[model samples]
Target: MPGLSLWLSPPPESSLYRALQDLITDLAGSVPAKDAPVFYPHITITSNIPIECDADEVVAFAASHWAADALATVTIMDFGPAFFKKLFLRIRKTPALTQLARECREKYVYGLATAEEGDPADQAAVWAQDEFDPHLSLLYTNSWPFSDEQKAEFGAKVQTVLETHSTEWTGGLLTLVPTYRSVDEWKPLASQLVGSE
Candidate 1:
């Protein structure tokens, strides 16, 4: 059965959120639909929570553990060309961010097993398989091996937009979303604001 996942993202009201949306709009216009698809900015905390995991349980877990503090600041390091990671901002993983991800996986993915905390080897694993390298993706490509020219074009476009802003952003809304379908089909089941009452 398909499952749910946790996503940490900038709330719509934030300037960083608006800037990312604008960048998505600009980039989406140029790429052919078959090449890539636009998506909201997010750093996935955990993917493929068992469908049996109650949505409310997950939301409450996140809220209780993380609501008192804002999410860790994320810095855009560079760009990459992998399919899901196509034209993405590589994020600098901070200790707080790593801890957040580990907690999520412990409760949801590994069923609270200390021995099962996520492994770095899993970083190359597919989406359903777990890892904790955090990044805010800008584009999702349908095809593999995007030509160098195309990748370079996308990189230039990304740099042109992001160069004007600091690479770091902090705080976000945490959401539980069903991950059983296409990107466009996925929607949030519940959400909580970090560091907000």
Candidate 2:
């Protein structure tokens, strides 16, 4: 299987999720107002792989390896927004999440490479190293309605969110995203996280 990566994202009730949604409403006035398909607010647990991976198998593997669900309490304790030209929120690495990522990647995902090894496009993904970046994307690809100064100000505002918002990873859906290399092509694969409540 290929195209399997874990994700940490907002439950509908999350403050951070709402804040970004609010920003989207604000930007609707000026910009075209669509988040990049893969750019919705999410922290990637893993990424970069071929597309033929079995979704159900990946989910089953993750559920089996995890410690019977866990505290969804997560925090983005560090600031200083970084982006690939677009800005994103970064978090200090936590052993719990890192361990979760490694187990899934090494056990389930790593083995799937051979499934797509012969296809030229798939081979590129198999050879590439997918690094984990614990982050929540705040903005991507000039899609927001804010001006440059506004963008700066928007980023600055999020610094406050990073500073004050400590969130509990309450039980929410386990989201799986597809990589047709486009958001339109990607679909969410989800399971309920055993929440902190």
* Prediction 1 global C-alpha lDDT: 0.69
Model 1 regions more than 4 Å off = 33-35, 67-81, 112-130
Best by TM-score: 1
For candidate 1, lDDT tens digit of each residue in 1-197?
A: 15788888876687778888788767667676665566677888888687767787797787677734444454653445566676677676665666677667666776633454555334323323345678887877655565778777877877776786556656678888887777776778888777643
TM of each candidate vs. truth:
0.79, 0.64
lDDT digits (tens) for residues 1-197 of candidate 2: 13645666666577766765555334333334454333455566666434566666666666555553443444442323332225555644555555656666654455554654455333334433345556655554445334668566665665565566655454444556774445455566654443425
Runs in model 2 lying further than 4 Å from the true structure: 1-4, 24-39, 67-85, 114-130, 142-151, 160-171
In Å, residue 42's CA in model 2 sits off its true spot by 1.4
Model 2 residue 174 distance off true place after TM-score fit, in angstroms: 1.7
Query: Highest lDDT among the candidates is held by which one?
Result: 1
